[model samples]
Target: MSKLQNVFFPLLAVVAAFIVGAIVIAAVGDDPLFVYGLFFSSVFGTIDGLSYTLFYATPLIFTGLAVALAFHCGLLNIGAEGQLQVAAFVCAWIGFTFNLPGLLLVPMCMLGAVLAGAIWAGIPGLLKARFGSHEVINTIMMNFIAAGITSYLTQYFYREPGDPILQTKHIYEQAHIARIAKLLSPLGVDLPQRLPLNLSLLIALAAAGGTYFFLWHTRWGYDLRAVGANPAAAQYGGVNVARNIVLAMCISGALAGMVAIGEVQGYRYRYYEGFSAGYGFTGIAVALLGRNHPLGIVLAALLFGALQRAGLFIDIFTDRVSKDLTVILQATIILFVGCEELFRQLKRRWAKPA
Candidate 1:
């Protein structure tokens, strides 16, 4: 598909999703306009809402990029959930165990997080490459294994003495990333401290740029993309498909691990059980809606983040409509995007300019 169509279909999907959502609301006898107005207002009108939206967007950005990168390599990585869980645990472990100064400790924790995720994901990658196993099945099974292993480690070794929460001991302050509010306060932005938004957002933005450059500007990335586009042709042209598969999964997992930077270092400051709110699965939808493109992924993540924030507001402030609308909308969006083939005819008449 051309760039314009790549962008257009997702936008059309989003519009179609909201239309379906509005219909559902109207079917339930609530004014669709009232519900949607309230929802969008809550997401955009208040600083708290916007800040929280961006905070939530941080992880989605990471996970979305992870999924998108895998897509670029013709790989389906459903293992981001497991990859992130393992990485978060490792990050917390490094944080508390090392207790080094910020200059040293923070980077060490980040490196640990990335390596943990890479190793976890690389297992499935290796299995696929060497044994001809399906990555989807391996990755899904790995999620369960990761959850059990992380839970055991936290319960037996990392949990604070007698703590009721299924979480590890807090990382030292030196490991914590300053919240965006604190960082901005020195420059007079003065955002409320309650907002969990942090430097991870900047990291996400940089990741997007880096992903774009890697996928479009580099020889290695070109080989990976060629493999994804046509593995048989890629091999005929001297690209090593197996190595790229493993390498792509490792890179994808590394991106997924960046989620720990936000969750462990920015907000919770610990490896908390159930910290993720289906970020891995939601990322699949984000990547689809973004057409597996980095810039588009960032935009899609923001939209989902805003929708997430609006869903919470609907739960709290509305009596007739519920947060389930957001779920319905998201599902509809995915369904619509999956039907992009329906746009093929139009694209013949509207091909993107070179």
Candidate 2:
């Protein structure tokens, strides 16, 4: 395929997915046009809608990058969900417990979250590297451990004092994120009060860029990529595959953890039960759809974010089709993407002279 063809792959996948979605819509007795119309409007109708989509896209960027990082090391990270939750809880605790100046407090809170996330993800990496354990099994089990530990911390250790709610106390005023709504108010846009977009969005973008530079430019990333592509060759080349695996997993976990910290610190300013809402798992799909490229991951996350932001509207406008259809769409996209290499090979064969 030419460069143009390579670039068109995602667009083609989206078109194919939508065609399948139309079939699903027909099967569910709804008008596909109306459903798609609702989707486009919800994502692009107004500045408010676009802001919501961007806000939703923020954490997805983190999780997608996390998964992409792990993929580069030939490791599948399925524990981002738990790592994010734990990091959020830790960041919230720091933000609330301290009263330092914003300059000092912000970095401290962020550092706390990153460290916690890395540690949470690093354990499985260590086990896999040292003991030759399968990362998939170990990471899955570690997710359970993270969940339990976070649940306990939230329930007892970090629960707000004298509050009936099962959530932490609000962070310091200075720690609260500046909302995009505040910025849009000057432009005469009346955004809904429901969704919150914060400064962490900038952080996520920076992380995405950093991920790209690291993967494509740095020597360390080269080593990690070498290991990912061929472990035996990398080992023979003395690249320390074990160390790279653990480090890559830690980086991936840190990104996931940053999602929660960004969300809570910028929006809620508190840790609550069910704060994540399955972002980690969705990130796997996003990474796959993006082909593990930093830019691709960002775009893929934006697509999913738009879909999620518009899902409720789809349900409201077309009651026949359930909101779960968005999930179905995401699952289908990932499944198809998984077979992308096969499709490429087939296309190559088809183009060959008879």
Candidate 3:
């Protein structure tokens, strides 16, 4: 496919998605214009709402990047959900238990989350590399394990004493995220001081650029891509396929871990049962929709984030449509994007030789 076609296809898919969404809205007797109006207001009507939406998008960027990175290496990292949970729990543990200055405490909590995520993802990688196990199976099962274990830890160990809910104690105030409205309090938002779009967003952006550089600009990245493209050929070319597989999973897991950074360090500043809400699963769609490009993943994450923000707004105004609309839209987009590679291949083959 030509470069123009490559770009055109995604735009077409988006237009199709909107048309479908409009049809659904009509069937439900909800006005699409009203839904869109609320969406616009929620996102841009007030600085506070926009702040929340972008803050929500921050962690998604990390998880999206995580899934995209693994997909590039031909690995199906179904474990991102579990990896993120473990990272969040670990970050909470460090945040609540450790007594350190703000500078050291913050970085330490982040480091702990990253390490936990790496370890969580590494388990499946090690299995796949050594035993030739299918990562799809191993990673999926690992996600369940991570969820169960993290829930148990949150309930038994991390749960804030005297609180009935399954949640951790608040992290030290020093570790709390800086809110944008609070930072610029003289210019107050109409609502309460909005949470700042955290440092994690910056970190996520950096990760994307860093991944792009590693994948397209570095020797190791070349080896990883070569292995992903064809393991037997890469092995023949002296790339250590086993080592690369493990490394890819580790890096992927680390990115997943950073998702917890946004949610825990920036948003909640604590861990809770069911805090993640299936970010890992959404990440798979993100990876496919992004064509596994780092920059593309950022865009995809924002799209999904916008849908989520809009979904909440839609729900507020209409009893007919639920937030599930956003999920359906996301699923539809993924289906189309997943088929895109096949379409591109067909186009390549159909083009006659000059």
Model 2 C-alpha lDDT per residue in residues 1-354, reported as the tens digit of each score: 466765577667777788899899999899999999999998999776788889888989999999999999999999898888889888988898999998888888889899888988998999999999998888788878877887787778778677777787788977766676666678997666556877788889999999999988999999999999999999999899999999999999999989965688788888887888689999998898787888888899999999888888987888699788888888888776777776688779899966
Measured by TM-score, how close is model 1 to the native structure? Answer: 0.95
Which has the greatest TM-score? 1
- TM-score to true structure, per model: 0.95, 0.92, 0.91
TM-score for candidate 3, please give it. 0.91
For model 2, the run of ten residues with the poorest summed lDDT? 1-10
Pairs in steric clash, model 2: none
Model 1: per-residue Cα lDDT over 1-354, one tens digit each: 577777778998899899999899988878888888888898889999889899988899999999999999999999899999999999999998887899999999899999998999999999988998999999999999999999999999889999998999999999999899999998988788888999999999999999999999999899999989999999999999999999999999999999999999989999999999888888888899988889899999999998888998787777678988988888899898988776665666588753
Error of 3 at 302 (Å): 1.1
Cα error of candidate 3 at position 186, Å? 9.8
Q: Sort all candidates by TM-score, best to worst.
A: 1, 2, 3
Give lDDT per model, in order: 0.91, 0.86, 0.82
N/CA/C clash count, model 1: 0
What is the alpha-carbon lDDT for the whole of candidate 2?
A: 0.86
The parts of candidate 1 lying over 4 Å away from their true place are 343-354
Candidate 3 local lDDT, 283-352, one digit each (tens): 8877776668887778878877777777887777786988888888887787777677766676688896
